[model samples]
Target: MNTYLHSVSLDREKCTGCTTCLRHCPTEAIRVKDGCAVINPDRCIDCGECIRVCPQKAKHVVCSKFSDMEKFKWRIALPAPTLYGQFEELDDIDYCLQGLLDMGFDEVYEVSQAAEIVSEYTRLLLKTEGIKKPVISSACPVIARLIALRFPYLKDNLLPLLPPMEIAAKKAVERALKEHPELKREDIGVCFISPCPAKASYVKNGFGDYKSNVDLVVSISDIYFQLINSMKREITPVPFSRSGVIGISWATSGGEATAIFNDKYLAADGIENVIKMLDQIENGMIPQLEFIELNACTGGCVGGVMTVENPFIAKARLQTLRRYLPVSQNFLDENERYVPTDCFFGEVPHYKPISRLSNNIGESMRMMADIQRLREELPGTDCGSCGAPTCRAFAEDVVKGQASLDACIIKTARSKCEGCKNNNEG
Candidate 1:
C-alpha cells in the first residue's frame, strides 16, 4: 500500500522546463530542476493539470492498451459518459456502445447507468441520521486524493460509496460469470474507458481497503478514432444504452448534485476554485449546504486531459444527446431505500497528508518556528530559480536536509552585498 503508481509521466526530451506546469499546478508538486520540470509524487494528487497545461506536450498519460484486453476470454468495456460527448452531431449513445463491441469488446457497460444507482444510494445516505453534514462526493478520484493529501480533516466527509466505474466493473464481472456458469473470475477482464489520469491512478491503486475490479484503464482519446470508424461501419446500434438523462448529465458539472433533488448542495469544478471553496468550508463558512460536489476537472469529467473534445463543446454535445432520454433509466427497487452494504468502500487509512509538517507535535512546532525565521530572511517573491515552488517550501526542504540555505539565490546575493558594504566601511 505504500507504493503509489501515477498515470502521467514527463517526456524529458519534449520538456523545456518553461515553468508553465509549475505555475498552473494546484498542489505545487512541480519544480524546475536541472533544466526540466520534476514532479514530486508525494505532493501530486494526479489532477492532470500539468498534463493539460504543458506547452510542449511533454506530459503523457499511460493508458491500458487494447492488447491487454485480449488476455481474458471475456472483455467488458465500461465507457464513461464523457465518451458520448466526443463525437459531433451524435444523437444516440448506442452508437458508442455498439462501437465498443465492434472494437473487440465482448460486453459494453455504461458507467452512467451505474451512476443512477449511486445517485439513489447518495440520496439514501444523506437522509440517514448521524452522517457527516456537507458530505463530499467521492465520484472524482482526483478530488478524493486531493482531500486525502491536503484536506485530511474532510476525510470523514467523503462519501463511502464506490464510484460508478468501480460499481459498474463489479456488476459487469458478476454478470459475465452468471451468464457463463463455466467461466472463472480470471476469465473476465473489466476495462474502464476513462477520461483522465486520475481515474487511471484509481484503477492502479485501489481505493481504501478494497482492490479494484477494473483490470485496465483505457483513455477516451486513445480509442476515439477507432470508435468513430466502428460506429460508421455499424448501421444499426441495437438501442442497448441503459443510461438516461440523469446518467448522461453526470458527465457535466452539477449533474450529480442536481439528481439528488437537493437544493442545499454545492457543485464546483476546477482545482483552484475547489481549493478556495474547501478552505472556506473548513472554516465553517458553508453550513447551509448538505453536500459538496467537487470535480478537479474544469467541466466535470469532460474537461479531463485524456479527452479529445473541448469541455464546453462536449458538454453541449451531451446536452443534445440527453434531449430524448428519460429522467433515469436505472433505479433501486421500489421497496428498497437502503444502499447495498457491498456498494460502500472500505475504511480509508489515515496517512499523514502533504500539509502535515511532522507527526511529533514538538518537531512540527520547531519546524514551523524555523520556517518562519527563514521566511523573513528569504525574498518573498515566488521565483522558481531555487528549484522550489515557494520560499516556505524551500525552507521546509532545508529543514528536512533535502536542500541548503545557499540555494536561495536572492538571500545569497543579499549576503554578498552586505559583506561588500562591511568591507568598504573597514
Candidate 2:
C-alpha cells in the first residue's frame, strides 16, 4: 500500500454529509460513508477541489502557521508567482514581496526566478532529447500525482525536472549560506508561500525519491489579510525585482508553454479538461504536438483554492503585471549557464486499479456481468442522492459490496409505491 501525506482533510463536525465534493472530485477519491465524507488517500491528488466546492466549509488544507518561522534562526520566504495576482490595483510586485519581510520573514525570494531557470532547462531538454512526443509539464504537483494515479500510462511523458518551488528553496538556502557564514545549515529554514494544498503536500512528501528542500508550506489564503495590512503600511518598496516578465507570467494558464516558445504545444487548465486531453494523447491522437502544459486548477495558480481573488480577476491582474515588466534581457539566451543539472525526476509509483471488480479474472468477469444487470435495474438518473457521483458509479459500488441497492432513493421510492399498490389490491 502506498501511503502519502495529504494536505487536504475534512472536519467531520462541520460536514453535513452532502455530496457536493463527491461530484466535483476529478479522481473520485471521496465517498460519503456513515453520514460523513471519507477521503481515500491513495486516490486523492490533493488538488483542493473538494476544498473549493465544500458548502459547509468542512474541507480544509493543512498548512504551517506564522509561528513555525520561530523554529529556525534564519527564515527565508519563497513566494509563488501567483501571490502578485491576489492584490488588486497593485503596481509593483516588490510591495507584496516586502510584505513577507514585514510578516516576520528574514528574507524573501521569488519563485519566478527559479521558474525562469527551469524554463531554460526545459527548452534545452526538448531540443536535445528524443524521448517522447507531447512532453507534459511536471510543474504542477497535482497534475503529476493525477498521472500517477489515473493516467499511469502517461508517466513517461512527465518532464524530468524539479519543480520551480524546489529549485527556489535550494537556491535560497545556498544563497543564505554563502552570504551569512555564521549561520549553520540547520539553522536556516526555507518556507514556501503556496497557492494550493497540492504544493503543500509536495513539500511534505516530495516527488519521487528526492527530499524536499523546503521546510514549511504556508497557504496564500492563510496570510492574505496580514499581507494586505502589511502592504498598506509599506514605507519603501524593494529597489529591484529579480524575476522577468516571462517568469511572472507563469501565474496564469498557457504561461509556461508561451515562455518556452513552443509552437506545437497544447496548454490545458482544469482537471476535467486535462483528463480529456490525456485520453486523446493516450490514444495517440495528438502525436503532432510537441508539449502539453496541464495545470490542475482552471486558470493555473490563480485558480487555486487558497487564492483570495476570483480566477478571472486574478488572471487579469497577472497580465497587467506582466505588461509592466521590462522585456526580459535573458529570454532565450543560449549562453546562459545557470541551469541546475543535478535536478532530475525519479519513477512515480504505479497506482493499483482499485476500480477492478475482482482480483481473479474469472471473478472479475462474473462481477462485471452482475454490475451490468444491477445498472439495468436502477434508474439512470445521476442525481447523486445515493452519495455516488453517478448512477453507474452507484451500481459499481453496490457490486463491490461498498453500498446497498436500497441506498438508491429512487429505487426505495418506487418500491414504496409498489408496496402501496399491492396493499390496495389485497
Candidate 3:
C-alpha cells in the first residue's frame, strides 16, 4: 500500500533472492527480505545500478511505453545526446532525428542543443561572485539525489541550473505553441527518449519547486530496435546538424568540464569515483577547483545501462562524430537568444538530512551511542551473508529496529555453539 515514485523496480517473480544488487547498491536502498530484493523508495536514486548487475534480469526500469504516445495529438521526441552514440558509422545527426519521426513522433528535438544553452549559462554563473567553491553540475539526477541522501550538507555546491533534457523539453513545447496556435498544450506530449531510469523519475517527480516540462519518457533500449529498423530504410532528413561539438560532447565523460572554458575543474565519472571526489571536496582537499562535473555512469551518459552499444565504442563514435562538423559559436550565441525569460533552474530546496535517527536531540544522541556500541561488538568483516553491506550498517539497522543482532552470521554461529556447550553440561 506504500506508494512512491520509483523508476527502478524489482520483478519479485523473477528474483532469485541473490545478494548481487544488495552488495552493489550505492545508497543501501535495496535489502534482501522475504526471499526478494525490497527497494526502499526514499533511499533509491534510480541510478539503474541493480539493472546492470542482476544476473536474473529481475531489476527493470519503469518507463512510458510506445503505446502511451497515442493519447497525444502532437508527439515530440526529445532525444538525449547519448542516443547519437548508439548507432555505428552514423554520418549525419538528422538521420537519427528523422528516424525518430519514422518511429511515429510528429517532430524531434535534440537535447544537445539544450546542452549548449546550459553550458553557456554555466559559464555565466561561474563568473558571478559569492557562489560556493567547486560548484557541482546538476545534470545527473542520480548524483543530485546521492548528495541529497548521503551528503545533505553539500547541497549548496550543486549548480542551480536546469539540466539539458528539461530545458530542451521547455524549448520544444514553446516552439510547438508558437508554430501551431490551434492546438492545446494538453494535446501535445513531450516525450524524452531517456538513457536511464533516473531521468524518467525526474520527469515524473521534478526536483525543487518547478514542474517538469516533459510529459512522458521512454527508455532508449526499448526503442533501440525500432529506431535501428527505421534507420535501415532512408527517409527525408530534417537538417538537424545545428548543435555544436561542445554540446554533443556532453554525452561522454569529461565533456561538460571540457565545454567550460578557462576554469579549474575536476571531471569524475562513475558513482563510486564521484563519491570519493565528493568526500575529498567535503574535506577541503581540492580547494583550487572552481567546478566539478560528475556523471553517474562510467563513460557519462554513453555508458547508461539502457543503451545497447558498449560505452567505449559509443564514446569513440561520439569523438569521431565531432570531427565531421566545425565548432560553431553560433549555437552558443543562439542558446542565449532562445532560452526562456525566466531562470531555467528554479529554486532548489536543501536536502533533508538522512541520518536523523530521532526528533529529540537526546534520543538521537543515545541512538548514535548505541549504534557505535553495537558496531564495536560485531565483527568488522563486511561479508554480505547478513544481507547488509558492512558490519557498521548492520549495527545501524539493528538500532533502527529493522534488523536483529543475531542476523550477523558470525554472532549467530557463536550463539549456537554456546547453546550446544550449555546443553552438554546440563
Candidate 4:
C-alpha cells in the first residue's frame, strides 16, 4: 500500500455481501470477509472495475460532485464525446448544452476540440520522434497504466500527449475568463463528465503533479440515470441537435481513426483484443500500421464499466444521431480562428516515467528463486480461491512484494495441516 501511485477509496456503508467485485477482479485484489469487501492495496490496480460492477451503488469515485458546481459563478461542462452517445433523444448539441445550464452550469464545451489538437500534435510527433514504428495514444489513462504495468517494453512507443479532457478543460477555462475580463478565475469551475474512473483518478492524482483544469469528473453511468430522473421532474429536456458526427463517433472503436486516418491506423477495444494487438505489434508482426488507438473497454468509452445503459443501445442511439448531424469540419475553421496563446501545461508538474523493471536485478533474481521454491510447495490449482490467478502467479506476486506467503491457499492449507498434526501428536 505504501508504494501505491494512485488514489483508492471504499465506502463500507454502501457495500452488500455480494461477491461481484471479487469474481471479476483481474488482480484478485478484493476479498469478502465479515460480510464486507476488503481491497489488498498492493494488488489493486485502481481500474474502477469494482465501482463499475457494484450493484448496491455503495461504491463511489472520489471527486467533486455535481452539487459542487454551485460554488462557481460561471461553470462549464466539458462533456466527453462518449457522453453524446449515452442519450437517445438528444438530437441537437445545443440541447445538451442547455441541459447542462438547466442543471446549473453556465456554459458547455466539447472535449473533441482537444482531440483535434491532439490529433494534429500526434501527427507531428509521429513524423519526427526517433522512437517506435506505431505510437500508442495516451488518451485512455487505463490503457496507459496497463501498458506501464504489464508491458513496460512498449513505453517508448506510447505517444507522450495529454488526453483530450485535460487539454479541453484548460482551454475552456482560460477562454471563458479571457472573454469576460471582469470574471474571476476562482469563480469558475470546469467539470468533465468522465467515461471512466481512470479519468477521474488522473485528475485526482494531479496527472504528473499538475493541478487539473477539470474541477470535477462524474462517471457517465452515474450521470445517465441522474440526468434522466432530473429531466423527468423538470418537465423540459434541454433541446439538443447533432454534435459533429466524428466527435459523437468517439464513443466507439475506430472513432478517432474515422475522424483522422483510415487504413494506416489500427483501432481495437476491450482489454483482451488490445493485449493481442500489442503482442503482435511488439513482436514486429504488424509494423505496416503507422498508428494505434486502444480503449481498455470494448466499444470504446460507451462500453466503459461505469455506464448503465447497454452499449448496444447506446451505439444504436449514437448512429441514429450521427445521421442527423453535420461533419466536425463545420466548427474546425472557427477553432483555428482563435488560437490558444498560453501554454497551460507550463504551470503543471512534470512526471517521471516509472519503469516496472526490478531495481535490484540480483535481488529480484533471488526473490524469483524464492518464489519458485515456494511454488513447489503449492497445489498448482488455478481455482482463484487463493485470491490469485495461479500458483506461479502467486509466486510472482510474492516476489514483487504484492502478496504474502499466506495469500496462497495451498500453502496456507499445508501449513495449517502440519500445525494441526504436530499439535495432536504433542
What root-mean-square deviation over C-alphas does model 3 reach? 2.2
Candidate 4: clashing pairs of residues: 91-240, 91-241, 92-240, 92-241, 93-241, 95-239, 95-240
For TM-score, candidate 1 versus 2, the one ahead is 1
Residue 290 in model 1: lDDT: 89
Once fitted onto the true fold, the runs of candidate 1 whose alpha carbons sit more than 4 angstroms away are: none
lDDT digits (tens) for residues 275-339 of candidate 3: 89888887888869888999999999998887889999989988888987766433445435443
TM-scores of the models, in the order given: 0.97, 0.92, 0.94, 0.81
lDDT of 4 by residue, 1-426 (tens): 134445446789878757677776655667665567777654555677777678886666665567777788898888887776677676555555566666777777788667766665565556664757687877777776667566667876776666778888877888898898888888888889877777877787655445677877777766666665444433554544324676677778887766555468889987768878877876888858777899877788888766676887888888887787667633435445432433223322222223222568787678778878978877877665555546776676767776677766667788899999999999
Q: Any runs in candidate 2 off by more than 4 Å, and if so which?
A: 232-234, 329-339, 353-363, 413-426
Question: Poorest 10 consecutive residues of model 1 by lDDT?
Answer: 347-356
Q: 214-318, model 2: which lDDT tens digit per residue?
A: 999988888899889888544778655688887887888898888777788889999899889888888887759778899999989999998888989988988
TM-score of 1: 0.97
Residue-level error in angstroms, candidate 2, position 234 = 6.1
Q: Return the lDDT, model 4, position 69.
A: 79
The number of residue pairs in model 3 that clash at the backbone is: 0
Q: What is the lDDT of candidate 4?
A: 0.69
Residue-by-residue lDDT tens digits, candidate 1, 128-211: 999988899999988888888888888899999999999999899989999999889998899999999999998998888889
> lDDT of all predictions, in order shown?
0.89, 0.85, 0.84, 0.69
